[model samples]
Target: MSKLLNDDVKEMLTNILKDMVDEVYVKVYVDTLTCETCTETHQLMDEISELSDKIHYDLVETHGDKTVGDKYGITMYPTMVVLDKNQEDKGIRFNGIPAGHEINSLLAALVDMSGKPLDLDDATIEAIKAIDTETNIKVFITLSCPHCPGAVTKAHRIAMLNPYVKAEMVEAQTFHEFSAKYNVSSVPKIVINDTHDFVGNQPMEVFLDTIREAA
Candidate 1:
């Protein structure tokens, strides 16, 4: 009845978010010159911050700040790390956006973890397992784009690890017609059940959330 990320979930996030005494820091690690995804990555972060005001964004260019990268142990551009108030340790790290549904799930997990230090109960696990059993999600991707490979690998890895997940590769240049038909204007355009779609690489939690919703 509601969108994948509903008002209730948003409210829950806001509540837990309000309870936090420390600031949540989001660091965007990128290479200013060589990184092809820098511009779009900034745009995506902009969108994310617009959705929630709890995030503090800091753009760090790889070449410009060696000490900063060393401090964070960042070796990859377009890497997003969620740090707690202290900024000493990493709380949640997403390699790529899994999906909208997956992001919401991770947010819920973060909130739950922050509010109460524990894991999901058996019943909840069973429900999650049931959801996995009933849901099927697939992603068609390519291997050429630097970003494409990581996304493709993540999708495949997730599919291999989860029964309901599936990912296929379509050579972008070879299958240009099919790609065009899907309105895939860029690399790694994930399509869910021929219904939902989003472009670019996403955080892992986000990707999982998207798959969860599709399921």
Candidate 2:
């Protein structure tokens, strides 16, 4: 297959990744037998990693023991889990090929996970860190959706701040059955803990309200 990123795009990403202060790792889980987008997902990781010395990825196959996938709570193929500079899981994931506008979220995640502090107030950061309850945030989106990246970026930022919270970007089209379970009729549907859900690229406070309720 041809390269997913062309020369100009690669140049832009190279500059953006230069802001990374520390190394970041993305573990991509795949099952060749069952995953249709697994190949493209792996290729995308490769292309992104090539743009920066601070970025890397390990291709993990979920065909046998499933230990790695279990460790990361990855039950789906073509899932990319972003780890911090210390190679620790940051509860940030993309459960499909992050092409189109979703690519912005993936890039932002890599930069944010690399020892950079989130641009949030101290009180807001403390609030996120203090949430002791287990929180799961799933942002259902299609690759083409223009507004999806904003929602995904916000969810992932919260996840990066608190280990108790897990955030994932689920490509609705790729995971149609799972999307149906949430009745994801619109793009950028935000689901918290599988019970409280709302649609749109809502503000940070709105997201926190739903998360607080879930907590």
**How does each model score on TM-score?**
0.41, 0.96
Residue pairs whose backbone atoms clash in candidate 2 = none
Give residue 43's error in model 1 in angstroms.
1.5
Determine which window of 10 residues in candidate 2 has minimal summed lDDT: 61-70
- In model 1, the runs with Cα more than 4 Å from the true position are 1-22, 64-68, 96-119, 122-215
What lDDT score belongs to each candidate, Candidate 1 first? Answer: 0.51, 0.90
For model 1, the local distance difference test gives 0.51
What tens-digit string does per-residue lDDT give for candidate 1 at 1-215? 22434567557556655643435666777676755556555665555454456566787676655566776555445555555545533223333332333444334323332333234355534443353533333333443454654454445344434445434434444345656778877766777666666667775555666666775
| Clashes within 3 Å, all models in order | 21, 0
Q: In angstroms, how far off is 162's CA in candidate 2?
A: 1.1
lDDT (Cα, 0-100) at 204 in candidate 1: 57
Best by TM-score: 2
